[model samples]
Target: MSVIFGLAAAVAVVAALGVVVAQRTLYSALALVANMVALAVLFLTLDAQFLAAVQIIVYAGAVMVLFVFIIALLSPGAQERLHPLEARVLIGGLAAVAFTVVVARLTLNGVSVAASGRFYGRLGPFAPVLVDRHGQVQTLGEQLFTTFLLPFELSSLLLLVAAVGAVYLSRRRRAS
Candidate 1:
């Protein structure tokens, strides 16, 4: 099951990536939606049902709609290649290096808390009142709501900033 799921995820990622590379903005947005859906599925397979649902609801549903809307509104048209070949090569090399570093971190270190033993083995393997007591959202929520509520609320304020920035950017500028 794991092997099959992993292979499916790999295919989804590759297909979405190819779509992103394709010239059509609409197709690229759809491809991003596909990638997000695949990620949600992957989350479900890892027993993060809440996260999976939230991912689909928030990112795949809301975010993708926003992306498509923005693409339509902005209408960034296809343009002739502007960058010189050398600049493209330099950027490609930088991107490759970044990708290599990310893959190495994922493969060797593993990003999850379990692999890192974050919480420093405090979160037990199993406990009631949580999913296998994996201590992900539930624990994080507990800590945030109880101990770190202020910071959590503050984080939501960042969303307001994002909204303001979006309005400012989308609104037409007036002549001085």
Candidate 2:
């Protein structure tokens, strides 16, 4: 168990570092995929089966595909060589550090699963909220549909809008 946890953590960290440090965008994206897969495996080892499934399905599957699609649409070729001047590299590093700090802040202060009432907050209105107690799917489904149906439907709508926006943005633009 500890070995699995350690290995997953190492893999995730290294892959994430590669995502940041790789010169090629495609290599970075591949590294991001590796990081996501590592995270999914970590979730599985932690017995967060649903979370692991969602991680694999949403992030590794859907979101990565979207990123790849965008990369393909935007890039004219396989490799984009940057003339790495000191100012640009420094600015890039600063931006990366800022992003890292933001993520670290969110992660550290984020809700503790060790605390009592921690459900999947991302689902928002479509809340299948389980706090390690009262967590049966049927019971949760009843609660979501009864008390939280409105939010669930809204979230789905938001997803639909995002999908449409992505499709629109990816389409070839006409000359004005």
Candidate 3:
């Protein structure tokens, strides 16, 4: 399990670097997708199965798709290499390495799966909300709908605001 975690962490670090270092925008976006997937695996390694699925579904699947689509639509020549080995590139590389080291250390030292209060793995919670395969999903839904409802609604509202702002900016630019 530790070996798998290490490999996934390595992949995640490389992918994260690729996100910043790739010359082409599309390549960077693809790297970002890879990074997100590697992160999901890392989450799974920690027995955070629900978090892993959400990471893959939300960030890797939805967010990256939107990002890639927008890039493809907005910039025809986005594949062209813009910067090669600028000073910021070196700085970014150093920062990434530092960040990876910090995260790895924290994950290895601070996180403990067995210490989690909830019943994990094949164990049974058998609570009223759920009893089987959909236990995690049901718990997540309950939390989202009950405990975190305000934050969820706010996030949706935030997206709506962003969309409206984009349209307004585009129209304003066109009118100018």
Candidate 4:
């Protein structure tokens, strides 16, 4: 299990790096799809099957399709010239390294709390009162509605705003 997890993580990292460093938009989008698939695998290994499926379907499939469509619609040419490594880039790299070190230290030293405890291992009040045998979706829906309702509705609002913005931009472009 650990070996599989390691492999998935490694693949995800490489794909994510490719997304960032790839010269072409299409290649970057492809790398992003690979990264999303790797992440879905990781979610499966963590026993979050529902999340794994959602990761694949929503991110790897739908989102990547949208990205590819956008890339195809745009004129195929050098979008921007690559700049030489500057002082800001060096500083950003150092900051990223420092952040990684801090996160590693925190993770290594973190305490593993038992899930059966009163606090319920960080789930707190949001923990499911009764998990049905049906599947993760039921428990997730319960939590999302009862505990995380505000965030869920807010996310929907955000998505609505994004859709509206996309439509407005497309219309403006067409008009111009």
Candidate 5:
């Protein structure tokens, strides 16, 4: 399990970098799909089967397919290559390294604190009881519909707007 988790983590990191650094938009979108798949593997390793499935089905499947289709519709030209020693590249690399270090330190500290029973975070209301009774997926569905329905509907609305905008832009490009 640990080995699988480690491998997935490594793949996730590499794929995330690929998403940022890939030259082509299509390649970046593919990399994002890889990253999402790796994240699903990590979630699976953590025993969150529903989350893992959603990660793959919703993110890797639906979102990535949309991104790829957009890239295709846009027909973007090749990105200009930056020099290896460019100031922007150097600064970005340094920032990424610093961010990674800070995240790693925080994660390690959080794990140690939790393991030592020193982390006293607020507990969710009725989480355990709901999970015990209805299971994770059912509990999540209930909460999503009842508690988070507005936000969920708003997000769907936002996605619809984005899709409409994409189609409008693509049509405008073709018309020009």
Candidate 6:
């Protein structure tokens, strides 16, 4: 399980870097899809099967399709290159190194408490026993429909608005 998680984490990191470094817009989108799929695999290794499925279906499948469609529609040209010694490139490289060091340190020394005061090992209402008894999907669905219904609905609305905004912007661009 740890091996799978580590492999997925490595893939996610590499794909994330690929997304940022890929010259073509379509290649960047493909890299993003790979990153999302790798994240789904990581979730699976954590025993979050429902989250893994949702990650694959909603992000890797639906969101990637939308991004790829947009990229195809735009038909963007080649990216402009930056000189190796450019200030922006140097700053970006430094930031990447800083980020990597911070992540490495955190991984080596595990976080005990989150900024929100939640313990890292603390279980939520959906305990492992409950999850085993009722199944992960069932427990998650119950919570989504009951405890988190409003937030769930609001997020759906937000996504709908974003999709509509994207379509509107694309059409307006074509018209102009």
lDDT of 6 by residue, 1-176 (tens): 87888899999999999998888888989999999999999888878899989998988898789989988888665556658899998999999899999988886555544445555566775887789999999999998999999999999999899999999999999999
**Prediction 6 global C-alpha lDDT:** 0.87
- C-alpha RMSD values across all candidates: 4.7, 5.9, 5.8, 3.9, 3.7, 4.8
lDDT (CA) for every model shown?
0.74, 0.79, 0.81, 0.82, 0.87, 0.87
User: Which residue runs of candidate 4 sit more than 4 Å off their true CA positions?
Assistant: 75-79, 87-95, 98-102, 109-134, 172-176
Q: Which stretches of candidate 5 lie above 4 Å from their native place?
A: 21-25, 70-75, 84-102, 117-119, 125-130, 163-176
Q: How well does model 4 score by local distance difference test?
A: 0.82
Residue 115 error for model 4, in Å? 15
* Model 1 misplaced regions, further than 4 Å: 80-89, 110-130, 133-140, 147-150, 164-176
Check candidate 4 and list the clashing pairs.
none
Cα lDDT tens digits for candidate 5, 76-133: 7656666899999899999989999999999999899879986467756345555777
lDDT of 1: 0.74
TM-score of 2: 0.61
Ranking by TM-score: 4, 5, 6, 1, 3, 2
> Which residue segments of model 6 deviate by more than 4 Å?
82-122, 160-176
Work out the TM-score per prediction: 0.69, 0.61, 0.62, 0.74, 0.71, 0.70
Q: How well does model 5 score by local distance difference test?
A: 0.87
Poorest lDDT segment (10 consecutive residues) of candidate 3: 123-132
lDDT tens readout by residue for model 2, 89-119: 8899899899999998877656465465664
Per-candidate clashes, comma-separated: 0, 2, 0, 0, 0, 0
As a whole number from 0 to 100, the lDDT of residue 27 in candidate 5 is 91
Error of 1 at 9 (Å): 1.5
Q: Which ten residues in a row have the lowest lDDT in candidate 1?
A: 119-128
